[model samples]
Target: MFVGCHVSIRNGYLGAAKTAFAIGANSFQYFPKNPRSMGVKAFDAKDAEACRRFAQERGLVSIGHTSYPTNLAVDEEDMRERTVKHLRNDLEIAEACGSLGVVVHFGHAKGGEPLEGYKRMIRLLDELLHDWRGEAKILLENNAGQGSRMGTTIEELVQVRSLLAAPDRVGFCLDTCHAFASGLWRGSNWKEVAAHMRSSGYFSSLAAVHLNDSVYPSGSFRDRHAPVGRGEIGLEAFSEFLQTPELAEVPIILETPAPAIGGHREEILLVRKLADRQEGVFDLEK
Candidate 1:
């Protein structure tokens, strides 16, 4: 199984890859630029190429995450343009790094009608990708049902994709913490949740999983993430979800709070142990 945590790319692509490897991770996620800003640093093709080569040799998978400042549902002219520009740049960077794809938040409605907000998102994504030809996909991540965020429900996500100009190039990334907080998951019924998603058509487009534990109880609508086995959702739920046959080939990324790389390393080991135990395997050392 592919499992890893979100690693900082401040030291460049190769540096991030090395950090993931050191943590015993076979996969990792990274922000393509500053999460708080729209400014992106100059791309170093050589460094990206080296990182790709190293990841290929080590059987590592990498995924890029878009900046938090991006809001695809914006109705304003200048903000919409900038958001599209930044998103396009993110896709380009992901492609250059040979990443699986880039994960993006569905954006907020700013207190507007939910339907209008979804329409805005569909229009903007169409504008951004209508003529674009990139191998890297745009993976829309589910929200924690906080405020006016879109894509909180599988129905909403499916609706937006159906209206997209390039639905085939778009996909979904499930965040466990968000799922619990949004009440889409009751923390113990992953099988039911998975079945619901599959029937709604979201599961077929799922490309990645954010294997996080929630800081709050189910239906809390809070987006706090805690370390594996140290949160409300607990490790048992994760173990059950990890063994789901539907997600066997999808990469799992940890977005849990960690004091350092060591914290994430421990969580990674714990996840491996959980999966191994469920499968009746005993290869991982305690």
Candidate 2:
């Protein structure tokens, strides 16, 4: 249960590395460039080097998060082009930065069928996976079931994972808020959810998690993110996540807010406390 968070990489990219250390995180996620723009500025070689050194020095798992604006699942031809471009570049950047993986969304829905979106996404990922080959790993994040987004359900993700030449090159990053809002994971029944994720064949691509709280109610399918322990999802659910056996190897990162002087810091500490107090669950390698 390594704690991590998505931090700003705009300030020389190395800023995220510093943020990771500040929160005592075991890992960090960040964008290599501006997500909204098409024009890419040159990455500072020195800053990238600094990021690599900082991560190695602190033993932090650095994740290069892809820009989410481009929807690969969209039916538009232009979006497909843009998405393919980012996918290729993001993966290459991860390899260059000595990072573990590049995490990306399945695709935001625009009032379309999940299957249609999944097909588009599967095609896009397949194209990129062919080129990605090995080295830089990719993790597909499930959506919150908002609008027409694909991968909100585990089944859709399974289909996507089943395709692709680089199946082993890809994995999953479950968002806690999505899990709660989608009713796939909520309340004290997480044992069942954990079992379902495994017995249902979705566990093979499992990799990381985005720990978050929902601003909306369960089954809302909204994408609002709240601070940990301060929203509808609450701490008991997080307790369940900490206790799950299948998630032990996965990195649990706070996309939620923290307490004082905190973004995700307070949330990480809470999870760390829960993992530690729960006996032999999270081994603190001292």
Could you tell me every candidate's TM-score relative to the true structure? Answer: 0.94, 0.89
| Deviation (Å) of 85 in candidate 1 | 0.6
lDDT of 2 by residue, 36-146 (tens): 754444667787778888888878777777775757676787777777777777777776666778888778556777667677777887876775564768888887777
Error of 1 at 93 (Å): 0.5
CA displacement after TM-score superposition, residue 44 of candidate 2 (Å): 2.5
For residue 75, what is the lDDT in candidate 2?
Answer: 77
**Candidate 1 structure quality by residue, lDDT tens digits, 1-286:** 8999999988999999999999899999998888889865678888888888989999999899998778778989888888888888888888888888899987788875787788889888998898778788999999998888566788888888988879998998999999899998987888888888879888899999999888899999999998877788876677788888877888899998886545588778888878766553323321
Which window of 10 residues has the lowest lDDT sum in candidate 1?
A: 277-286
Give per-candidate clash totals.
Answer: 0, 3
TM-score winner among the candidates? Answer: 1
**Which segments of model 1 are wrong by more than 4 Å?**
278-286
How far residue 260's Cα lies from its native spot in candidate 2, in Å, is 6.1
RMSD (Cα, Å) for all candidates, in order, is 2.8, 4.1
